[model samples]
Target: MATHGQDPLLHSEVRQASTGGYFAGYAASIVLMLAALLVTQQHVLTYPAFLWVIFSLVVIALVAQAALFFGLGLSPAQAWKSVSLILTLPLFVFTIGLSVWMFHSLAPRVMPDTMPGMDMTQQPTLLE
Candidate 1:
């Protein structure tokens, strides 16, 4: 007679135990993410728009960690495992897009106009 250990599939009890560990890890990750968000918010004034990059990095890290450890169980064949990578790609793209848009929108206002020394007055003075 073959022992349970000889079986290729894991026993229910063992699987449950592994899943419990994953859950605990996931919970800890969430707590860390929240703490990071709070800290980022508090210091945002010092960094201005740069804070968004930090936030995006934290979010991406937390999501990846959770997915890898907790296994979303989206499919019997582990289709959920791919979700972390898929989600991360879009997040990076969005972050870059926001950063670029903000820079372009704000930079022009901060710098002098390209037509240097040109007066922008809408109406000329009576003496001129």
Candidate 2:
């Protein structure tokens, strides 16, 4: 229950909105973006390790944004929001992955077999 009147329909289970959390989430997002840029600019890790680190940072940032910025939590009232997000996450990733895979498969088939100006035919000389 809130001291000030809050719309029951909107916030049935009320939680105090925190400016600190919002700022923290924003700062964290900025740091993650800078870290990604640094990772791309400086080759500090091998390919596999570099990819894993970037992926880990991305997942952490996603969670931070979901919790702090979006106010998603595991509480009874908010659990459904979290559940829905989790359910949709895989679908979203899968759709993007599938799109890239399709493009990769499509590229080779559509590419020209040879250079634009090169002629493949063998022309017999007049002496022959």
**Model 2 C-alpha lDDT versus the unseen true structure:** 0.81
Model 2 is weakest, by summed lDDT over 10 consecutive residues, at: 115-124
Which residue runs does candidate 2 get wrong by more than 4 Å?
1-14, 43-51, 109-128
Residue-by-residue lDDT tens digits, candidate 2, 1-128: 43458565455444546889999999999999899889988987899999888998899899999989888988776799999999999999999999998988786545434435434353334596
In Å, residue 23's CA in model 2 sits off its true spot by: 2.5
Poorest lDDT segment (10 consecutive residues) of candidate 1:
8-17
Best by TM-score: 2
User: Residue by residue across 1-128, what tens digits does model 1's lDDT show?
Assistant: 23566764464324534666576667767776776677777764557565766677577666656455645455544555566667787998889999999988787655546435644463345698
The TM-score of candidate 1 is 0.40
Give the number of colliding residue pairs in candidate 1: 0
Per-structure clash totals for the candidates: 0, 0
Highest lDDT: give the candidate number: 2
